[model samples]
Target: MSAPVLVFGWGNPSRGDDALGPLFVEAVEAMKLPGIECLTDFQLQVEHALDLRRRSRILFVDASGTARPPFEFQPIAAARDDSFTTHSVSPQSVLQVFEDLEGRPAPPSWLLAIRGDSWELGTAPAPSANANLRAAIAAFTAWLPDL
Candidate 1:
């Protein structure tokens, strides 16, 4: 059998917008695609990096404060190093670690980042962000058929 397609969502749920990543994973889970594994976490870890090494393809969903207004959905080919200074390890760093341990041939990966506002506790995503999230989901769903 081929390696599975993994959809991983990472973020802190209590931190408003940071919850977008895990939320997206839940949405994807509802679709119940064969060969697709859904994993959600508060943040990316070394273990998660190892898990990614075994996949054929990986889709990472997260919220980004750097993104422009109205939420933006773009395919990220590489994770950024700056993520190390942030609350959690960046996806790129995780992939790099996996490569160092596993000797390359890592799965193809993509990052879907949603622009977010109001990351404080007890807060929710702004209305514009909510709409953007829905659009992002629709776009992601359309891409699945090709996979």
Candidate 2:
């Protein structure tokens, strides 16, 4: 059966700290947890809204320079903006799209932002960022049970 929990992690793997989101998805996948699905992408796009169908909960994981690592998680309400009229969209915009097309509210959703200090292309992740990433994986893994 398809998993009810959907985690979509997006970042450019070629960039240094930008790889954190996809890396988290990989760590979670290695656990082989039941009833959870992990997906990775380079960025959030308009078409991603279609992925929300039948999901129980959704998480958009991304690397953020502003996040005070190991990570930050928060609920995001569906909202639309004139800027979202473009091909790409924010997680909130995606939720809004899901609701607009599905004729109902999107599933409960949250955002997970992993802090990264460097985003230079072709460079490796800094040690500090890697430590933060590991901590986030451990912390969130435990917290998932309560979701």
Candidate 3:
């Protein structure tokens, strides 16, 4: 059976802080927790909507230059947006696609936006970004048990 919770993270690992998404997924994978399926990609695509199937909850992680420091977690809902026309879509857009394809609402979802400042290609993740990542992981772990 598919895991009831899906953690989908996406970012370009080659980019500095942009690696936060995949790095977050890596950390979660190491935890080896039950009932959680982890997925990482360079970016979110329309096809990712299929991953929502059979999931009771979903978490979309990404490095955000605009998010508050450490991270921010907030509930999301299906919404039709301009992102649908782009190759890289947002979490809400993916939820909208899932709803469109299934003719039903998607599983409850949230965005775990990790704050990131740098995005230079080929450089390693910034030390500050890594620190924020650690904090995000801690917060996520604590909140997960209540779910």
Candidate 4:
């Protein structure tokens, strides 16, 4: 059977701070918890829509400059956007595509935003970014067991 929860994280690891999403994936994978599936990519593409299929719940993780603290979690609803036609789509757009293809509503989904400052090309995460990543991982570690 498919896992009940899917954690999908995407970001460019080579960019400073932008690696938060995929790093979060790595941490979660290490836990090897039951009924949870983890996925990571450089970016959210339209092809990723299929990942939502057969999931009971979904979490989309990324680094956000405007988000606060360790991380921010908010419910996501499937909604079609003009951007859906593009190759690189947002999590919401991916959900919309899932709905379109499956002819049904998507599972409950949340977007997890880990705060980050710099995301320059070809740089390691800054010290402050590492702090944020640690906090986010801790926060999710606590949250995951309850799911």
Candidate 5:
């Protein structure tokens, strides 16, 4: 059986601030929280829909260049948006694929977008981005108890 909650974080670790997503997953994994599973990827793909099965709640974490300072957390739903692709997709696109495969709506989901200012390849994550990541992780940890 799968965990009741799924936390999927995606981003390229080689890219400066883009590494926030995977870093978030790493932190969560270290927490060793029970009943929650964590996964990380360089980017979201259609295949991730399979991971959504048997999950009660899903949290998609990503580093966003346009997000507000610290972070942004908001509910999301399955939608046939332009972001759908086999190589790279959005959280909503993944949810849509899950629904398409299951013939029903996907589990409730939310996106936790951490603010990122730098994304250059082969560069270290920016201090500001790391700070934002810390804040986002703390918020998620607090929210998990109510899940």
Candidate 6:
């Protein structure tokens, strides 16, 4: 059998909107899809790259602070200079690490970002952010069947 797909959700659960990534991963886990593995954590790291080596594909979910509006969810492919100096290692960097560690086939990868606000402790998402979360959940749910 082929290796399973990995869905990795990265973010801080203690921080308000930052938890969205993990939350989305939780939603995915609850679905219990066969041949897919779901992993959620506070952030991406070099260790995570090594852990994904056996998978055939990876879907990374996170909350980002780009120019896009709140709750924006988009799929991203690998790119040059993708390191995140402000946060944990970038997804692209992780993929690179995987390539270095394993000489064989590297898994296909994609990134999904949810626009977020209010990273303060004990705070909840604002109205707009909640709406975005709902949309993101819907979109992610729709993609689960095909995986």
TM-scores of the candidates are 0.86, 0.93, 0.98, 0.93, 0.96, 0.83
lDDT of candidate 1 vs native?
A: 0.77
In order, what lDDT does every prediction score? Answer: 0.77, 0.88, 0.94, 0.89, 0.93, 0.74
The better-scoring model by lDDT among 4 and 6 is 4
- Kindly give the stretch of ten consecutive residues in candidate 4 with the minimal lDDT sum: 80-89
Q: Roughly what TM-score does model 1 have, to 2 decimal places?
A: 0.86
Model 4 lDDT per residue over 27-52, tens place: 89999988999999998987888888
Tens-place lDDT per residue, model 1, 42-108, is 8887667768755878888888888765445544444447665667787777777677778774677
lDDT of 2: 0.88
Better of 2 and 6 by lDDT: 2
Error of 5 at 17 (Å): 0.3
**lDDT (Cα, tens digit) per residue for candidate 3, span 1-147:** 789999999999999999999999999999999999999999888899999999999999999999989889899999989997887798999999999999999999999999999999999889999999999999889979777
Q: Which model is ahead, 3 or 4, in terms of TM-score?
A: 3
Assess candidate 3 and give its lDDT.
0.94
Task: Give per-residue lDDT, candidate 4, residue 113.
Answer: 95
Tens-digit lDDT track of model 6 for 99-137:
767855457777778888678887776566667667887
Off by more than 4 A, model 3: none
Clash number for each model: 0, 0, 0, 0, 0, 0
Q: Kindly report which residue stretches of model 5 are placed more than 4 angstroms away from their true locations once superposed.
A: none
- Which 10-residue window of candidate 2 scores lowest in summed lDDT? 81-90
Best by TM-score, which number? 3
Q: Model 6: runs farther than 4 Å from truth?
A: 1-3, 70-87
